[model samples]
Target: MSGVAKVVAFMQRSWWRAALVFAVLAVAFVVFGRYAVPPSTALTSGALALELVGTRSGAVAVLRAFEQQHSVHAAWVSITWDFAFIASYVAVLVLALRYFARPGEPDLIDRTAAKSAVLAGAADCLENLGMLAMLAASPQQPPDWLGFAAFATTVASLVKWVLAAFAAGHALWLAWRKLAQR
Candidate 1:
């Protein structure tokens, strides 16, 4: 069998493990948000405002807001913690997609959902890097590249959310159907 088939086989068998890890990571994510990171108004903004601040001015404003609230370090910590969360979520989603597949063959939707999970992870990584870069730059007198970084980060964040939602929704729907049949 091909490498892909081997991986699918492995994932199909390890779905429970993936689900366990995902549960742990989800709790950790919440803990990090609540305790590890300091409370701040900037951080409490909606997801899009936090991740999709597309314009340079908007990015600068966010940075300034964090600084003013004395939560820049908290923002950094949150982003760092998110890296691990991304891995866990992607793994769980992919495994869940594979779990719904036939013994040796994944249907097109399953394959697509798995691929979307991976792509979402990649996009999230890009968005985190861009946010880090923006944080590194001076929000007051932003660098020329800051605008591009903001735009790119916004795009990546958008892609990540869309793909992740699709993958997660598909997996949940499949699970729901399975449960209903049982």
Candidate 2:
């Protein structure tokens, strides 16, 4: 088998491991997310500022205000925490689609959906990088690459959510079918 095929086989066999990782990281994301920013501020900016800020100054101002309330260190740590969360989230969702679907030979659609989970995870990682870069630079006078980072972060965040929603819907459908069989 090719390297990619081998990796897929491994993933197919490792659903429980992925679930364990997801459980651990989910806890971290929830805890650090709470300490990183206020719940009200989250409504406005969110973890990676899912809402469009439209301008570099606006983005910087928001980050600065966030840092003032919660130290920049917490914000940085939260961004790092997101990395772990994204990886585990993708793995568990994709593994579920792979192994928990109707018991039969896998089809092209199943494979594609699993791959999309990885793609979504990649997009999320890019989103995290852009957010971290912006947060790191926000303390400066003008903030380096503020426009590009913020724009990329927003776009990636949107892409990640769309793919995530698809995975979630697919998982639910599989779950319903499984339950109906019982």
Predicted structure with the largest lDDT when compared to the true one: 1
lDDT value for model 1:
0.76
* Per-model TM values vs. the true structure: 0.81, 0.73
> Please, what are the lDDT tens digits per residue for candidate 1 over residues 40-65?
55676722465789998898888887
In model 1, what is the error at residue 61, expressed in angstroms?
1.3
Predicted candidate 2 versus true structure: per-residue lDDT over 1-182, tens digit per residue: 75434444664576675566457657765665554444455434545453355358767776777667764555566667767777667756765675556566667767667777888989988987777777677455855578777787788888888888888678778768866887
Taking all chains together, the TM-score of candidate 2 against the true structure is 0.73
Which residue pairs clash in candidate 2? none
**Quick one: RMSD of model 1?**
3.5
RMSD to the native, candidate 2?
4.6
